[model samples]
Target: MKDVVDRIRESPKLPNPYHIGEICVLLPKDNPDLRGKAGYWGVVSHVGDYSCTVQTWDGDYTVKIEHLKLLELLDEDCQFMQQLCVRLRQLHQVASRDSSVDWLLQGLGKQAKPYLSSLQAKLLAAVEREYKLVWKQPKQN
Candidate 1:
């Protein structure tokens, strides 16, 4: 969708895993398949010219550049979108409280209405909880 594309374009450019901290894992393309899936989320431990090593929550693995699709990166974007969706929903609820504000909420409600679908909600919640963001303080910092 154009909206999705616009959102992706607006997203901050994620730095390569190499610059991240120790826990970052460069997920392997062979042992695991992370394409369009929400399960694989990790940090990059090391990066060579052609491949990168990642230290995942379960273990460490090396991945080649070609196989390193943007699945997890897209997942990260979804995570952010989830947060925004939540905020928008909260705003809608607040707007509903006052009759005058209801008009404004009507427009926002239409845009966010799709996310409220039961199936999509369930899947989003599951992915959110599964690949939940885990912030790790840098050892040196």
Candidate 2:
């Protein structure tokens, strides 16, 4: 079993082979700053030769491409993810103002799912309401 695992680990794999705008999950094992943010979803904002800048709900992170696992979501789903990103950002801002909400934020940060269920969405909305965080529509340019 150990030999098999070693062989699998030794297999050739692509590194930093991702494009901008792609959705990916962070592998936080190697980064102390991202310790509790493992499995969080982020969108690639910039792609460099060895690393990519990913925009998450909390903030932007520049990590090696190899540390990300691309999430193949549908076009519609991708759009939903973008919207969710905005919502999460708003919620995070509100949560930051009150340290009591840290648990909620921590739980959200650990979400590994590519999408949230209806109940989960409703629960998040309820939390936002509790915090008086209103969702504002984007202004037309």
Model 2 regions more than 4 Å off = 1-16, 95-100, 136-141
Clashing pairs in 1: 24-43, 24-44, 25-43, 25-44, 25-54, 25-55, 26-54
Candidate models: Cα lDDT each: 0.42, 0.75
The residue pairs found clashing in candidate 2 are none
Per-residue lDDT of 1-141 in model 1, one digit per residue for the tens?
999999998988655544333222223445455433223334455777666664433334566655444333344444443343343344433422445334433333233222355654454344334444232322542
Cα-based lDDT at residue 124, candidate 1: 36
Write down the TM-score for model 2: 0.71
lDDT of 2 by residue, 1-141 (tens): 999999988988555678777788999877886777788888888988778988888899998776789888776666667667777777777634566455555556556455777877777778788878787645645
Kindly give the stretch of ten consecutive residues in candidate 1 with the minimal lDDT sum.
Answer: 106-115
Off by over 4 Å in 1: 1-38, 70-141
Show how many residue pairs clash in every candidate, following the order shown. Answer: 7, 0
